[model samples]
Target: MAKTLDELLTVTAPVDLPSYDSRATTGFDGKKADAEKQLTQLGEELSNLQEKLFAGGRSGASPTRVLVVLQGMDTSGKGGIIRHVAGLVDPQGLAITSFKKPTPEELEHDFLWRVESRLPQPGEIGVFDRSHYEDVLIGRVRQLATPAEIERRYGAINDFEKAFTDSGGILVKCFLHITKDDQKERLAARLDDPTKHWKFNPGDLDERMLWDDYQRAYALALERCSTDHAPWHLVPSGRKWYRNWAVATLLLEQLRALDLSWPQADYDVEAEKTRLAGM
Candidate 1:
């Protein structure tokens, strides 16, 4: 029998990224149709959880928050995950950020500074489309920073994450795992359609050439940064349907673990109802 998602995922340290199957779909034994049905149900549950979580925080019922960090190579369906999973939540309760090449102002600050400023507020779900992991992944691959600087960043990232989690934040980092072949197909599909041409960047081909280096960088980052406070989940993204389902499942699992409750008003409800009824 195939393994469960928890077994298939890489949440613990000592991870061997190369050994992880990008094509993994070991848990669910369903076709696209079945996965879609499950995704619909999961979406409904997630919507409810998001509202309650948001309400709890907004009403001072809870201080808990959530942050989802998504990192992957180009054409890895990060956009799709946003539209499918995070899109299910109420806009008021959702916070989304897409990290890109740093600006002059951003470069002046510590790498994590910008990210820290955008964390989810209490009872909110914050999604980082491409998070600080870029510093280690692309920074290492493209030699944007010195080797010593890169090494220092690993420690800095761990400390930042520890502090964040200590503050009632549930951090879930997911690395969308897709094969080189999958990327090629995705890129090709985009090219074959004029509407998607906007998504294509010539520089992506340049980065594709350095795929091996990026892979190594990711492997090192995952191994070094995976901690009990916040762990990494290597989500197989070869199949779009399965990828969406797995990521959605992960989000639902984390939200359920919070055990959040609807906040109750302190005033007497019966008396308030009677008074309002008289008016």
Candidate 2:
């Protein structure tokens, strides 16, 4: 029997970041054209499941929801996943939040306060471009917070995720893994094309200089926060097409596990039909 994608990609134990090949498409052998074709095939089932999920939530028939938390270094294609994968479902069914530097008001509250506010509603699929993990990732790397404070966040995150799962929410936490060489090439492309200049940032180079530090940060975050309820999947994102396909497949598997059905009519359907005929 074939292994499931979740089984293939999920971080079951502590990972040695240096050992893993970011460019290698782990567990998948199909070419780019094949991946794209598979993605198109995934669309109908994904759309149907999303519709059922949305309808169930809209009518207060189900409390189930999904939150896809995407975390990675710059140039990791978080936006691309949102555009290609989430685009397979209805736009109305998705709640995407692209986290940036905290605003003054956000800074005043606990880190999770803003994150909790932006969670997907019952039946919606929430996608976080960058998420609460930043507090630990950049927070540790940049020494933005006290050591003790950063230490406290790991347990806090586990508890928060536990509560979410206990409340019928499914969390899909993905770490988009890419190689340093892969990133350098991508950044170079951004600089080479005038049309892509808008995507280029000088500060990205500064971040690139701290690549080893960021990898350590990510490794720790993945090891600590990948819980039983919300395990993190390390996606090899060196190939854009495979990344899109894999994320979509992961989501499809989650939605299928829900076994959603069209909500039953709340009123007398036969009577409504007669009434409509009379009208």
List TM-score per model, in order. Answer: 0.94, 0.97
Across 1-279, the per-residue lDDT of candidate 1 in tens digits comes to: 855465567556666666777777757788999999999999999999999999999998788999999999999989999999898789899999998899999999999989989999999999999998899989998888999999999999999999989988998888998888889999999999999999999999999999889888888998899887888889989999999999888888889888878999878999999999999
Pick by TM-score: which candidate is best? 2
Which pairs in model 2 have colliding backbones? Answer: none
Candidate 2 lDDT tens digits, 8-92: 8898667787777776777677888988998998988999999999999999899999999999888999989999999999999
RMSD of each: 1.9, 1.0
Clashes of 2: 0
Clashing pairs in model 1?
none
lDDT of 2: 0.91
What candidate 2 gets wrong by more than 4 Å, as runs, is none
Which runs of model 1 end up more than 4 angstroms from their true locations?
A: 1-4
The true-versus-predicted C-alpha distance at residue 217 of model 1, in Å, is 0.4
Worst 10 residues of 1 by lDDT: 2-11
